[model samples]
Target: MEPRLDLLSTRAGGDLFTMLVSANNALAASPLPRATQELVKIRASQINGCGFCVDMHTKEAAHAGESPVRLNLIAAWREATVFTGAERAALELVEQGTRLADAAGGVTDEAWADAAEHYDEEQLAALVCQIALINAFNRLSVIVKRPAGSYRPGRYA
Candidate 1:
């Protein structure tokens, strides 16, 4: 399918995306586990219905040797047995953070506490930022109807 807007072709879009990608790359320095980071992004993208991001992150996760079982089960993570407790906490944060309007008062204290239990302040900061960033990217992609299935792992890198 043709995109409604070629976000990379226009100078404004290009400039915006460059900054966005840079911000995304900077998160690589965070102490948060790479697997958790990728999982968070994938889950947030899925919640936001951003297929482009889902394709990109799932492939990137696989490229980094993430288990296919974990990748496939993210949507049903609550029922999956492949994730660690910490990973489950992060996934809960992603869902609550991504679907803020679904619940009143945004992310609940319970979810935040759950995440806090697994992550120190530094890692929690990264997780929150990751959630925000992925949601922003998701909105942009969904708004432009970004086509999926063509992304190469690290294409943004």
Candidate 2:
């Protein structure tokens, strides 16, 4: 299916997306592990129901050597035995951060504390930024009705 609007074709969208992509690339250089970054992006995209992002990140993660088992278990991460405690903490943070409207207060203290246990200040900052950036990308794609299933690894790069 064709997109309602081609985000890349417009001048404003091109500039905005360039900045967003740059920010995401910078976050990738953070101390947070690459696997953790992919998980965060996938989880946030899943929560936002952004098919384009789900396709993009899942493929990218796989291309980067993420095992299918862990990728498949991301939605059930809490009960999965494959993930480390730190990965679990990051997943929890992504969940709460993405579903902020469902919670009475934004990102509960418990989640933040749990994340703190796994990540240092700088890593936590990176995590938070990744969460926000992925959510932003998800919204933009979902709203624009970007079709899924055609993304190639490093297509954007």
Candidate with best lDDT: 2
- C-alpha lDDT of candidate 1 relative to the true structure: 0.93
Looking at candidate 2, the ten consecutive residues that score lowest on lDDT are 1-10
Model-by-model lDDT, in order? 0.93, 0.94
lDDT of 1 by residue, 36-111 (tens): 9999999999888899999999999999999999999999999999999999999999999999899989999999
Query: On residues 31-96, what C-alpha lDDT tens digit does candidate 2 reach at each position?
Result: 999999999999999999999999999999999999999999998898899999999999999999
Task: Report clash pairs, candidate 2.
Answer: none
Please identify model 2 stretches exceeding 4 Å from their true place: none
Task: Report residue 107 deviation for candidate 1 (angstroms).
Answer: 0.6
